[model samples]
Target: MNLKNLKGDVLELGTHKGGSTILFAKYLQNINDPRKIYAVDWFKGLPYSDEFGNTDEKKKAKGRLNDTSKEFVESKFKQFNVDDKIIVVDGLFEETLYEKLNDKVFSFVFIDCDLYKSAKFALEYIDNHLEKDGIVFLHDYSNFLNRPKYDWGIIKATDEYVREHKVQFTENPIAHFQKITSI
Candidate 1:
């Protein structure tokens, strides 16, 4: 992703351990781009799974991946010296997405919420604020090992959005959806 050409800031949902968030910040730093990256996450791990058929009981368990905290992610960012480029928002998507970032516009969004409802909400909410040439990266859209070992909510939510918006969707390991000005 060419962050230099993008107009608005970056938004990353589901930032666990700040891995991808740090990468984005470093890229922006290298490019001398002043755009800020907002990393939103509960930081408590996966919420209760949705009523998707592909989700298993283990995956459905709330707090399944609640090992990382906001402070841990912040420490990682500080270690990478990219803490200046990121703002970590701590809360559930339903509680924080709009309340905290409603006024911001995003040129790129990385969605890794790992659940249908979370992905769907992020997609719909970001669509209005995304730039015409904005890019959205959906993690786990193809699941692990390109097999159905995990929940298929990402794929289903992304497909539904693409179909509804008539936008282009590409799955090169991870799914990429670019916003089109005109269909």
Candidate 2:
């Protein structure tokens, strides 16, 4: 999407410890945009299964990224003085997305959820809710292309979504899709 044309609210799918969320907040601050940032994440960490054949039951049980708490993330936002412009939703996307935010619309969505199914769901959901000319920045997409050490789930999900919907997309800094017309 055109940076000059960015409007309406922003969304983040995976807010791990609020690092990227902080940057998004700062970007909004620099632009003087008053729209709120809806940061969604499973602060309890991530879950894993045998679907990919590299199941880590122990890690899933212990909760990866569980070291960070929602309160800590909130504090980081407060420290940046962007807390007032954010709404933190702490839950699994599948359970919390439509249930808690079915009524909301977004001009920009940042997808960082590092899994196939989760990323797929986020893309589809954003496709339905994103306004015309809205943009989506998909993190972890390059892993399938340049990062050989990483898994391909995010890339697989993204490729499938774009192909199935016939959405135009770009990659590099991230996978960006600007909604211009129905395909």
Best of the candidates, lDDT: 1
Write down the lDDT of every candidate, Cα atoms only: 0.82, 0.77
lDDT for 136 in candidate 1 is 89
Cα deviation at 95, candidate 1, in Å, is 0.7
Runs in model 2 deviating more than 4 A are: 3-6, 50-62, 143-149
For each candidate, what TM-score against the reference? 0.89, 0.86
lDDT tens per residue, model 1, 96-160: 98898988889989998777778889888988888877888988775545576455476678878
Tens-digit lDDT string for candidate 2 (13-81)? 989899999888888889888888999987877654313323364224335667777899999999999
Error of 2 at 172 (Å): 1.7
- Model 2 scores a C-alpha lDDT of 0.77
TM-score, candidate 1, is: 0.89
Which numbered prediction scores highest in TM-score against the true structure? Answer: 1
Cα-based lDDT at residue 15, candidate 2: 94
Error of 1 at 142 (Å): 3.2
